[model samples]
Each structure stands twice: as C-alpha cells, then as structure tokens.
Target: MTITETSDGSITIVALCGTIDSSTAPELHKSPAIADTLRSVVIDLEKVDFLDSSGLGALVGTLRLKQEAKAAVLLSCMNPRVRKVFDITGTVKLFHIFDDTSAAVEYAATHNEG
Candidate 1:
C-alpha cells in the first residue's frame, strides 16, 4: 500500500493506492503523520484496487481516532468495489464521501471555513 499526504492549511488529504490488507494495514495504522494531523482528513481511495477486512478495520479505527481528536475524516473517490464493501458493511453512513479530489477539497474547505 502507498499513502501520500497533502495539506492546504485547514484540511489534510491522504491519498491511498494499491491494496490495503492484513499485511499492510498495520503500516497505515501506525503512520505518525496521520496520527498527528489535527485537521480534517480526506482519504482518497480512487487508486485503491482492493481492500480486505483488515483495511476496513483500519479505516474504522482511523475514524475513531479522528472523532477522539474532534477532527473530521472523509472518504473520497472510492471505486465501485470499494464502495460496495463500505455499503455492505454499512460504513458508508459513517463518513462523508465525495466523488473526486476537487469535490472533497471543496467540501473540506467550505466546512472548515464555516
């Protein structure tokens, strides 16, 4: 799995690519960069091809962390398969999802500004 982070003052976008499974979930969960950021987190899943239960757990854990910090975390650009998984698991309702990078950024900006 690959994770990239970009921030524009008020929001932090974390773009994820490749598969997120049991083998790689720990690495993502332990990222200090993600843990330390207080701004809202927008997870871009456009390039992610596969996700397993471990990945789902990691996401849920991350969401909990964000809640604890009083920060927002959004999931964006999820492909059909990924979206299906989230839907079946009823996790889609737990996050604010966007269709693209621009939309996610705009949503974050507007929410943060208000």
Candidate 2:
C-alpha cells in the first residue's frame, strides 16, 4: 500500500492507496502522521482498493489513540466497499466521515483541541 501525508494547521491528511489488509495494517500503524496523537488527522481513503478486518482494527486503534490525546481523527473519501465494512461492523458511528478530503481537513482543523 502507498501512504502519502500532508499538513494544514494542526491537521494532518493521510492518503492511502492499495489494499489495507494484515500486511499493510502494520504500516498504517507505524505511519508517523497516524501515530502522532497530538495533531488532528484526516485519513483519505480515496485510492484504497480494499480493506479487511486488520485494516479496520488499525483505524479503530488510531481513533482510540487520538481520543486519549483529545485530538480529532476523521475519515474521508471512503469507497462503497470500505464503507460497507464500517457499516456492517457498526463502526461508522465511531468516526466523522466525509465524502470530500478537503471538507474533512477543514473540519479537523477547526475541531482539533490538542
């Protein structure tokens, strides 16, 4: 999987491409932007082709970390397949999801408390 990151104010945007399964989940966890609990984060999944349980776990873990730090973590541009996983698992309610990356970034920048 490919991960690209950018920053705006206190928000960091992480864009992911390729499959996010067990193999790639660790990389997601190790990402500098994702690991930084002090900054708000927007995870852009526009290019992600597939996601499995491990991927979901990584996302949830990130959310938990951010919550502990009082930092915001949102998701953006999730495709139908990825959305379905969150829906079926009832994980959608746990995150603020946006159809647009820019919107997510804007929201994160404003909502960030850390």
Candidate 3:
C-alpha cells in the first residue's frame, strides 16, 4: 500500500492506495506521520480496493489508539465490499465514516482542535 498524507492544521488526511491486508496492516500501523497523537485524523480509503480481517483489525486498533490519545478517527470512501466487512463485524459504528475525503476533512476541521 501507498500511504500519502495531507496536513490541514492539526487534521491529518491519510490517503491509502492498493489493498489493505495482513502484510500491509503492520505498515499502516507503523506509518510515520499517522500517529495516535494527532487531534484529528481522516483515513481515506477511497483507493483501497480490499480490506481483510487483519486490515480491519489495524483500523480498529488505530481508532482506539488515537482516541486514547484524544484524537478522533474518521474513515472515508470505503468501497462497498470493504465496507461490508466493517458492517458485518459491527465496526462501522466505531468510526465517523463519510462517503468521501472532502467531507471527512471538513468534519475534522470543524470539530477538532489544531
């Protein structure tokens, strides 16, 4: 996976491309700038085509981790199949989800502290 970031004040937008599976989950967890300390985080999964159990685990862990540090995690553009995984596992309710990155970014900006 290729993870690119865009910074808007304290809100960090992480755009993830390619598949998020077991092999990539660890990489995402250890990504340089996507720390749990950020006050606002928008994880753009628009380009992510697939997300497996491990991938879901990583995301769940991220939300919890960031929240512990007083950060809010928002997910954006989860494709239907990948989204189904979240829905099936009841993890969809755990995050603030949006249909696109723009909304996520906007929401984070308004609701979070820089």
What local distance difference test score does each model get?
A: 0.83, 0.89, 0.83
Better of 1 and 3 by TM-score: 3
Task: Give the number of the best model, judged by lDDT.
Answer: 2
Worst 10 residues of 2 by lDDT: 105-114
lDDT by residue for model 3 (36-83), tens: 565578899888999999999898888877777777889998889888
As a whole number from 0 to 100, the lDDT of residue 108 in candidate 2 is 79
Positional deviation of 63 in candidate 3, in angstroms?
0.6
User: What's the TM for model 3?
Assistant: 0.90
Off by over 4 Å in 3: 112-114
TM-scores of all predicted structures? 0.89, 0.95, 0.90
Query: lDDT, candidate 2, residue 93?
Result: 89
Name the better of 1 and 2 by lDDT.
2
